[model samples]
Target: MPIDDFDLAIAPLKDLGGQRVWSLMISLFGDLARQEGQIIGGPVLSAIMSAMDVRPEAARVALHRLRKDKWIASEKHGRISHHSLTPEGRAQSQAASGRIYATPDDLPEHWLMVVTDDAETGPLEKAGFTTLMPRLYVGDASLPVPKDAATLPGQAVPDWMKRQLEPASLAESYAQLSDALHHVARDLAGADTLTPLQIATLRCLIVHNWRRLALKHPALPRPLIRDDWAGLVAHQRVAALLAAYPRPDLPEIATA
Candidate 1:
């Protein structure tokens, strides 16, 4: 069936969290308008937020917060305000995009482990290690590893270690997001063609939630990841859906 009201179709996504306005705005800008010179005009931004059921005043306040935080810069051309990521903000967004849009194919083949020391902890953490406990770190073998460390190669992780990597709360969140994503995929599959604004809003909501989960997930080998890991399933679904609803240009969305 066609989606008569976009909000109802995406209720699972909207209800996934508290819908922090500023954070949602960040995801909106990051997903839709983070490129250099890309601008999301006030009306287009407003339309997307409104379609997602965000209140006008809440969006305004979130914009204000982004401006204050130096994550976004705005210009007033006539009565409309156009916003784009700041240089620093753009760089930050770009860094995050690596994770947010990464595919399941990027999962590492072998995981490297290090029994890190106090000083080594900082470097290991920087190198993307998941600390199972004090001075115990595991990360992708593809990334740089430090000297003076006895590293081990692992094809699979034990339940005890997996518990540390995939905490109960994180797994639950992933499962919930996965269910919501399947809902969206089904909804979009049968729905009528979406407007630029509608497409942008839906993409942002999915990316926002995926970003939250993906960023927190430990970088690990394919074998280390659970066979039924919801996060992995969610990752696949997100990738497919994003491909299905390709991003629209800023101008197209703004003019719509």
Candidate 2:
């Protein structure tokens, strides 16, 4: 009955690739094992995954894929397997961490804009600059400018730029995730205590989904965003739920 209710509460998450075992595992490492030489045992990984209804075989396959892709590396010590992020993997995870963990308060009010020649737009876009106009891009104040461009402080944002901030699909996706979190929080209230494994599973689901949506949208101020932006609501809800269900200790989850 508990699992059923849990499943229903988080049903909306499934549509957002919540069951992607490999991706979820990558997210798990990014959240808990990105530190230098941090390794998670195979059993510990399985224990937490079981909470999310992932099968052992699926986890193994995902690990295999991750290793093949250089996202993770594993060593077997006397039949006990330990896994850690590869250097490349850690780099990717660290790059994403800032966006994933940033609170609304972390965003700066002012931004930096770079206007470059049309031929140079490729490099700017690849470097995470959001397109504001042809050959015009905007990013956080700290964004570095290439030698050819002149950096200017962000001033008034035109309506056209605001409309371009978030595409319809991305806005809708964040709204759906926000709404799902709301449902889960309300449903789980006063429920029986969840095992450590169960809590870890739910936490992973919440973080993985939230991170994708949060990271996709650039960190910009409220005035730069549409008034009806769902990202703001999503971030608030995610923070609240994470506070309510804190991360369990690695040992507790692994043993459970």
Candidate 3:
């Protein structure tokens, strides 16, 4: 994986408590390397607490957890215990760095959309619509009419449809629509029957507007779309949909 891709993976970890510990560990290691080439336990803990603005007790707990997890090792030199990243810790950190720095191809499809969404300048601008534009299909006339006449049959509209109805206050609607698209994309990406093409499209949508999705749905984690891997199964669902609704023109052309 490219460095960029690894960064994307680590992006989610930053929100977890483990991230604080990881940061402190890295910082202490770097400082020790620059100064004495190694850090003893007491100084390591103090530096970590001071740099992280964490309580000494909290820093101690984090250090204990890291040691327990085997991310670091300690050896006694006379009276002081010197600490450093273990071989295992070094390997894990390198692996994490690769994940954080991985190339785009190593990244899932939805990540493309996320990149797009991050570039827009407006309060309600959604990203990657060019790749995964929603298609609105009206139900047949036999379907019950909506109580709101504005939503009558033959008037199917894209997620941006609300913009036409309420132009002046469309920002709120844009936020809602962007969020709904992210939800739909996540659902489709995780489904068992979506095709590769569909998954690709969904991934594009999610990557572009994940923040909007989180903003509109505060209950969702910011990295839900980025970290989830269930999207691989959604290809099966797309295949099923394609099988159920094969292109009609192909049959007619073959017959002709």
Computed on alpha carbons, the lDDT of every model, listed in order, comes to 0.82, 0.78, 0.36
Write model 2 residue lDDT over 44-119, tens digit each, in one string: 8877777667888998899999999999999999989999999999999998988777766676677888888765
Give every collision pair in model 1: none
Winning model by TM-score? 1
- Cα displacement (Å) at residue 57, model 1: 0.8
Q: After superposition, how far is residue 256 of candidate 2 from its true place, in Å?
A: 3.4
Question: For all the candidates, what are their Cα RMSDs to the real structure?
Answer: 2.1, 2.7, 21.5
Give a tens-digit lDDT track for model 3, residues 1-256.
2333322332321222223544455433432322223344554445324433457777667768878888667677887666777676666555344322233233322211212223232321221121122232122233333242223222223435322222233344344433444344343343454332222222322222232222221111112222222221222222333233232221232222
**Clash counts for the predictions, in order:** 0, 0, 30
Q: Write the per-residue lDDT of candidate 1 for residues 75-137, one digit (tens) a residue.
A: 999998888999988999998898888778877777777775564456677678877778778
Model 3 spans with C-alpha error above 4 angstroms: 1-19, 26-41, 99-256
Weakest ten-residue segment in model 1 by summed lDDT: 116-125
Sort by lDDT, top down from the best = 1, 2, 3
TM-score winner, 1 or 3? 1
The residue pairs that clash in candidate 2, if any, are none
The TM-score between candidate 1 and the true structure equals 0.92
What lDDT score goes with residue 178 in model 2? 80
